[model samples]
Target: MTDNIDIDRSLGFTIAARNARGRLVRLGPVLESIISAHAYPPAIEKLLAEALVLTALLGATLKDDSGQMTLQAQTEGGPIDLLVCDYRGGELRGYIKFDAERLAEMPVNPTLFALFGKGYLAITFDQVATGERYQGIVPLEGATLADAAESYFAQSEQIPSLIRIGVTRDEHGCVAGGLMLQHLAEGEEGRDRIHTRLDHPEWEHVAILGSTIKIEELAQRDLPLETIVWRLFNEETEVRLLGGASLTKGCRCDVVHIRDVLSKFPAEERANMADDTGKIGVDCAFCSRIFAIPVAELENAGETTK
Candidate 1:
């Protein structure tokens, strides 16, 4: 089945397309997930959705089964401290630092460099099961995430690709959704074929259809996936199915994990916390879940995972 199959729901949908060879995939979504860690306004909420969509789109291209992808944006700007999202199996969980003043200063035309003034953007891939990880540091370029990501791909993988990303608030004005489309590396013949299609009258026609996707419609309208595909592609265009997926928030936090982190802490800090309470208090970064581990429990559990 094509990965781009439509979803029928009262909320939103995601559709992905990968060619027969699976060298590339285009994924997009209308997300309404409200993570409990922090509250965000409409604009930043939209930005987070775009970031999440981008992560999953990139994740679909991974070649290793155990590998995971992370997208991190850190800036000195207030109201928007940072945005981080991890993608695996189309599932995601992310958090952003929010600042009202910084968000107010955001111009309509934002470049990655300007938005994240004097900051770094990183993409990390890890084989969690095997404990091997690789990270790439990217200098922010252009004004949008698309520009930085495209540059990263060209520099890191030496692949030529075109990426377009859009984020908007739907009509109801409650949620955020995003769409990403990319053309991957193919031989001259394949490239020529794509160019020919782009030049075709229908190419502009498709772009026009895509333009109809207002942020309002995406946020408020609960359109079926099939309807969305039809709206963009005529019946004559064969949209070969590749796969479909749903994204949910997740975090890695457990009592043992908390204890393991506490073990690495300076004994002085541990002793201080122990003095205040019977145990040490730890919080998970991603979820902000608090775990109070008494010194007695840590002693009984051993200093490490058993």
Candidate 2:
């Protein structure tokens, strides 16, 4: 990669900045590891990619020490019933629950609404220090994940927002990226009139700029952050780069963590969890990794907890 391309090892940028138009914008790239973790088809992969970028953008807005940001969807009867992804400390992981039999019958390229039918999208941020979590939920109204998120901000936060995410898969695998622009209320006067529209003209102008973004452009794997920013807002005054962060796929699931959770259960409960083969097997829904614990191991774990 050229010097212009710092080529973030994790494959994304992080920040919260205002452009010359006085709009807040955030850029983020989705890591391929998060997409390749599952052997999902291109269609599903596309949606997953979009969700990942949206997750990263929202994750970047979180406080430095916040626990994590989780983006989730619940589709009652569609092919995909559940979608959950979490981002924390510049790392993210997620999984999808879909009907294999039904999925085979789905179109090679299905629309988000078709894939999800009637459902709900939710974004949550966990505040570890205060043991409090803030969340926003919106119906799955639009045809894209970005719409769902934009709706969350508009309705829940009462902030007008625009978000765009793009996904591309080649022989090398998949790469996804996205950007978001939000209009913030200024000062005490602007804050009091939270409903008041500030810089409405600039908001529309920037929204037009945001709408012009092509999914392919956002999908650039080697494109420098500077180039993308300049290309989008070169017409406006000086655009600044507040800061950037990396995106990585990290799994916190482990044998010890699983064992510790199971240890809390009474011996009877633990026994019930064992298979006919007398092994307690657990599967991580996120990474889809399975772990089997012998009965002795479970007993020992329980003793330690006691």
Best lDDT among the predictions, by candidate number: 2
lDDT per residue as tens, model 1, 1-306: 223233211111222222111111222332444343546665566567667656766765565645789999887643467889887655566777766776678776455555577766789988777788888877766667767886776676544334444454433333333443333323435353434333433333434545565444343334444454555544333654344455555566788677876676665667777856677767666676678888766655554444
Local error of candidate 1 at 7, Å?
Answer: 7.4
- How would you encode candidate 2's per-residue C-alpha lDDT over 1-306 as one tens digit per residue? 233242222222322233222222222233566655678877777787777777777887776645799999998668998999888887778888888788888888877888898999999999787888898989988879988888898888877778887777655556666778776554425354345356444566667777887877776766765667677777765565666666667678888788778777888988898998878888877777789987778787667767
- State the TM-score for model 1: 0.67
> After TM-score superposition, what is the CA distance of residue 219 in candidate 2 from its true location, in Å?
0.8
Each prediction's RMSD to truth: 6.6, 3.6
Q: How does model 2 fare in lDDT?
A: 0.71
Off by over 4 Å in 2: 1-30, 188-199, 303-306
> Which residue pairs show backbone clashes in model 2?
14-245
